[model samples]
Target: MTAPTAPPPRSDAAVGTPPPTARPSLLRRVWTSYAFRRICQSVFVVWLVATITFLLMHLMPGDPIEIMAGRLNSSGMSHDQAMATAANIISYDPNANVWVQYLEFMRGLVTFDLGNSLTNPSKTVFEHVMEYLPWTLFAVGAGVVLAVVIGLSVGMAMAYRRGSWFDHVMTSIGSFLTGVPNYILIAAVIVVGYTMLGVLPFLDMRGRITAGVEPGFNFVFFGDAVFHAILPIIAFAFTATGSFMLNMKAATTEVLTEDYVTVAQARGLKAGRISRSYVGRNAMLPIIPQIALQLGTLVGGSIVIEQILQYPGAGQMLMAAISNRDYPVVQAAVIILATSVVIASLIVDLFLVRVDPRIKSEGQDA
Candidate 1:
């Protein structure tokens, strides 16, 4: 029987080979991709937030058209001209059905054409946002950087001296700071310095920069910008710094118990060297995700801070828009804030995958 021909000598390619797995469809593959999902999720969240804000703004008591028309009349425009101009600026018809208005808003959203503001008809909502959002971002960004540096340093120090007086004192300070809202802290400072101490120039500190400081890449403008932004920056940093310090301390303490850290210590590594390379490094991994969250939160929370500081950031613009019942601008600001958080979270999620390869490998397996 020729020994059954040994099954045709089983081709090496086929030998011990399992059946080929069916490839996932393009749709399935896209759905499963981490980055794709995150991006889609962010987009959906932004859309939802925009929709909700739109609905709420419409539901609010004031009619933006009337509000704008009244302002135009105050500008000495004829009543007929004022109403017509207001309608044109706001692009709203009081007679239109709510659904039609919604459709129009959605169309604008898709086209990236947020309509002209009721308050500032000369500029589109986007122009207003571009003008102010940068200052908010600068303040928030600087504050987060400063907070991270201070928190990490103080946190690491606290970790090293855990259970000691230094650690206890720092922990108390951190807890207090975190517990207090940034706005309250800012108010307290104003009360103490401007009201009580009569030191800080409250009036001069209220705007974006000194009135005469020319806008440029030069020192005078830059210094003035920093000066105006300082309070908002401190407000942003205070709570975040405290939270970071506490979190980092906890992370460090836990990392101290890890086997590898112990191994590094046993190797006769210098205290500073081991802490920096091993314990501190590993301890910081957890804090990386928190930084992204902190930024997102700060941007969203900037409204209150900016309003209080009279800092001409997106937050201040948003507050003004809301007060003026400027629907388009309000919608823009809400979407911007919510979208920032979503985008930031998505970015950090992707970044974490690169920082730790195991996360990527596991995601693939999933």
Candidate 2:
């Protein structure tokens, strides 16, 4: 019986009996986790977003209905006629329910069918969007990339050599420029270009290429298009760079203080290697989400810059639509811009998950 004494209680017992591991099926875990809550939250957000968008048009000063009546009848129709006509154009039939309008708006969005533009006689709202979106992407996208690269590089250098003359100069410059409004900077850039530089960009707030010319990816048109885009790009990039520099510099400084970074240094890693690989990667996590939000903001505000530069981006089109009370065009542009922001944010969330596993797990939980 003593021989059985559990084999002397086995000195290697714990080693043989390892702790149980969690290996829940991926789908099963996700179903019961906070990820499900996040999806529900996103759906709720979309509902609120739709309601807000619908209300935005309603809140504008001049009634689109009245404006349409004025446009349709310059001689001034009777109140009854105007009312009837507005109802017709707006699809405000007496029998129609609020839910019907909401459903219609949602359907139009899903189908990418934005209907006609009341402002632009030459093309449908959809066609107008197609014409302008590319330039916006090219100009804004290039400017963003340039700003991020330049800002990140300078910020990293400044952070690594804090209190140096170069750092002082950059910090001062970034802080100074941060105070200047984008519109003022854009105006100044244009003024400088036209006056000091003696180079005015051929800014035509129309199609990407010259009209009456067949479109092709040839050097002639391509070069001219790029040349036209350069000044606006510079203006946007210059305006955006200060914020990027300041933010990245702050993040880098904060990340440099992290314990892991200290451990990295303790490992005898080269300064360049440690800075580029460790510091830079960690510093960039915060910047990624920021860049996503900035893109959406830039797209929304692009009209101001576009109008000043006379660039035919979607923002300019949106502005024109708003000015004319072009309901279809207005709705289309707003939806496009809103949807872009939502999609960009979603993509950023996914990216954040990848960059920092904590965000993924936490976001799922939230």
Candidate 3:
């Protein structure tokens, strides 16, 4: 006993044992999470798009400086005078190296500082973009929401009434609408409604808001804005609704065939209760992600539609920028459009966890 006690209780340090490891911090855990990884991927894609756009514009045929100078010369300035003015107006510096200009551009992008307009030097590109972006967001956003809501209802009906005349009619309409391009729809409206029928009041709806209608929180101003945006909205809705309806119909039909649906039916659950509690909710799981994706793509694709409608939105500004070779403006528009799509996707992921009970249950178990 005395011999055993002679060996004193050895401390961890005395025994040359390693220290216990500390747990990972919350911030570190979050950074390594799947959701965070997805967000980072989206951000990286946006940055890559921006970099490609910058390089492509820079590598284009004409020198921005020379182009600007020539425009000024055409406007009655002498060669020397135009060159000097052009040097001042354009942000690209000929004297500096290409890498230097790229660095500056990237810095500006990171800081939310888009440079001044090359064509119109008075206002910064950010101001111009902000002025027009809201209209596009409102018009496109409304159209997407309208399409999703209507599509979900109609699609569910088609699933329930599978093989009926109504289903056949809707299925054909969906296919036809899906096949037609949105821009073509807009063109057809202009050609038939305005050119031939003279029924659209097309000229009256040419701008974002009517001239005499003062812009305010008042009904008249808002109403006028919506009036002008009607055609663009309608075009987007028709183009998007078909795809949503088809997708929803497919999802619902599949869900209806699952075993749980049969069990619910055998349990004597009311048709309405079973559809809402099980089928519709499950069907919506797939459609929700699509709605998010479609909303984002619609926003980016509104350029031609807005241009045709004279809607005075981001698309109109982008069109003007490209036509005028406004480099900074074009870059800004690209970033904004790309960001909208990526951010929408990220937001939808967050929503999915809330809408989907299985995801929530798994998360709790983990």
Clashing pairs in 3: none
Clashing pairs in 2: none
The parts of candidate 1 lying over 4 Å away from their true place are 1-8, 12-15, 19-31, 71-85, 361-366
* 1 versus 3: better TM-score goes to: 1
lDDT measured at residue 140 in model 3 versus the true structure, 0 to 100: 85
Q: CA lDDT of each candidate?
A: 0.87, 0.74, 0.86
lDDT tens string, model 1, 1-366?
445534456665677777678999999988888778778888898889988998898888968778878888998898899988878866766567888888989899999998887677889899988899889999999999999999999999999999999999999999998999999999999999999999988788888888777899999999998888888989999999999999999999999999998898888989999888888888988898899889988898898998788888998888888888888899998888777778878888888877777776787787
Model 1: residue 93 alpha-carbon error in angstroms:
1.0
Compute the lDDT for candidate 1: 0.87
Runs in model 2 lying further than 4 Å from the true structure:
1-27, 32-43, 59-99, 119-124, 202-207, 211-213, 364-366
Which lDDT tens digits does candidate 3 get at residues 128-180? 89899989888888899889888888999999999999899999988987898
Leading candidate by TM-score: 1
Ranked candidates (lDDT, high to low)? 1, 3, 2
RMSD of each: 3.2, 4.7, 5.1
Candidate 2 residue lDDT tens string, 1-366: 456545555555566976667899989887866446556666666667766776676567775566767766776777778767776756433244657866877787668766666545457778877778778878888887878888888888888788999999999988866777666787886678676786764444234566655657888877767767776676667756787888888999999999988998999999889888899999998888888777776777688888877788888878877877776677777766676677677777766776789976665566
The C-alpha TM-scores of every prediction are 0.89, 0.79, 0.88
